[model samples]
Target: MAYRGRFAPSPSGPLHAGSLVAALASWLDARAHGGAWLVRIEDVDRPRNVPGADEEILRQLAACGLVPDRPPTWQSQREALYQAALDRLVREGKAYPCACSRRDIALALFAQGRERTRHGELVYPGTCRAGLHGQEARAWRLRVPEGVVPWTDRRVGVHLQNVAEEVGDFVLKRADGLFAYQLAVVVDDADQGITHVVRGEDLVDNTPRQILLQRALGVPTPQYLHAPLVLGPNGEKLSKQNGAAAVEVAQPAAALAAAARVLGITVDPRVAVPELLAQAVRAWGARYP
Candidate 1:
């Protein structure tokens, strides 16, 4: 596999502090392992994508001296790949169409005397697992198997989850005719030969579902390292939705140093961007090796 790693970011906004932490961590991991570092624009959710956000994200990465080894991929242009993967799942009976909407799922859960999970995610009741029952199909969902799926995180250590019991049969294709993140990410990782994934801890919950998708699609699961999240002033995960400001790359070294601090790798912010990143790579190797 040659230790390939990637930093995939959605094109919803420019690189913010939290996103830079993820980007820096992934770049560090790739450099530390002497691997190829790649980038991918996760713009499959067309509605959320800003018109020029992808270009701005690349410019931001370049300013921080975290350029990819190859030209970045855009999920929006790869619908055929996702469709092919979904088709295989459908043929294998691992996926099926669902007619349930948000309200339908809520009502089904209520009937079963169940409430949303602690994370506030509504667990689907598999209402259309048998068939759509003549109702028009609204989306496609994977038929998650029963039993705990155990996986290890390089940073967070061991974790276990029963996808069937917890997440239920999650969507592969959404009602809006867009491919779900779970499916697009799995397919992209496999297609890109990504051997490692380094991102924020906020996405750690998504790992199990992605693992399940990898198994269903018969693709290799990459090693994961979830970096600590950078918090906002309100002590919440920093995000564009919460008005987290974009990284000011006018001073590249300072920006890179701030992100490195989140990864527990302190470096001289006064140095040039190249030297600062070099120091970061060494520190990261020592800790993560």
Candidate 2:
């Protein structure tokens, strides 16, 4: 397959320094391989989305000379595709409806002498795998298989996760009548023909669930390269929820150069955005190749 990569950003807020790092890394990866780079607005989580945030994100990227090769895609507008995928999974017996609320899951895990993972997520106890009993369905979950799921990351090398043990049957569709990120992202990447995924290290844990979804949906899995995360002053991952400020795109070259440094690339910040990106791309190709 041809090299095709994407930078999918949620519209919860404008692009910050941390988000810029991800965007720049994905753009450089695509350009380094002489591939097409695309953008997708991950606004599927409706409640968190800020009005006009998507437009502002696009503006930030444009100011930094990281334009997508094609018109950007919006996840909110692709409900039909996600519904079709969920329906197929339900039909194949690879997915089932669950009536377990967060409390129900906690109680069940407690009864089974199990505790939440270090990440504070309860490894769901498959309470509804057999049947929902008399309970009404509130969500849909994939029936993850046993054994280790092994995959290689371009930057991080090998990794293995047993989804059945670690994550259990994760949600495909949430109780709020929205498709989960794992499901929507998998479907979109397959639909968009994304052959490569370059994002921040924080999302590395999500790769296993996405890989499981791709297999269940019979779609091709993309190569992954998780760029280093940009940390806040408090030493935590910089994020919108953590009050990371929006990047100043007025000085696009400086913004891009700062983000490039996080990825271990040095470029002349005095140059224009286009020239700075060109220099970064050459440096990226040398490093990533």
Candidate 3:
């Protein structure tokens, strides 16, 4: 575990400015720590994946002088790995079949007049945790036990979440049969021996669920640093779903500079991409180390 890190991005769209910030931060931190930096395309959910988005993302990352140590891996091609993990969870009784649809959960909450939980999203009321109520199992869910998952983030400070109470037994495999991100990411990180995760703060909540999955799967949890997100003009997190504009790949240094600024690193505009990245990496090492 020689400071291995990764930047896993979904292939829903091209790299937007916000996503570039996440990329740069992950890359810089790896370089700063003298670690192996890897890239993984999270395209397991094929329905939402945009055609050509994966190639374009790789091209964009290279343009910004952020190259993966090895050819990037794709989640879609790693089905067997995910299936093995899911099967293990099932065999151990740590996970169970779930048949409740979104509407069923929503209606159940509405019946109880409970719209949202404190952590948001219709807190699944464990409707199918027992036995799917005589219906066919449509998905699989992790049996989150009651406890507090506490961890100190390198950047965001301490975070504690009661996964059982806040999120209830969460889905491991979706009703559509796609493995959930929580399971896929945990399995991938452990398999890759990832020791550090540097990404945007928007993913802060996802950490606890991932940590729980790692514990159940007997995998090591990585150090995390949730950096500040790049917000849109409207103050919303710039996201592909939010219609955030793509980064200007024609000007690699400019895009890198913008992302560096978001990470609080100052760069010389006159420098070329390589020099710019070298300077930024040094700055990141000083700041984070």
What is each predicted model's overall lDDT from 0 to 1? 0.94, 0.95, 0.91
Model 3 misplaced regions, further than 4 Å:
117-120
Model 3, range 1-289, lDDT digits (tens) per residue?
5999999999999999999999999999999999999999999988989999999999999888899998899999898999999999999999999888889888988998878865457788888776866799988999998999999999869999988878888988898889888889999999999999999999999999999899999999999999889887788888998899888989998889988999999998678999999999999999999
Provide the lDDT at 205 for model 1. Answer: 87
Candidate 2 local lDDT, 1-289, one digit each (tens): 9999999999999999999999999999999999999999999999999999999999999989999999999999998999999999999999999999999999998898886663777898999999989999999999999989999999999999988999999999999999999999999999999999999999998999999999999999999999999998999999999999999988998999899999999999998877889999999999999
Clashing pairs in 2: none
List ranges where model 2 is wrong by over 4 Å: none
Prediction 2 TM-score vs. true = 0.99
Kindly report which residue pairs in candidate 1 clash with one another: none
Tell me the TM-score of each prediction against the true structure: 0.99, 0.99, 0.97
Model 1 residue 63 lDDT?
90
Worst lDDT run of 10 residues, candidate 1, spans 113-122
The model with the greatest lDDT is 2
Candidate 3 accuracy as lDDT: 0.91
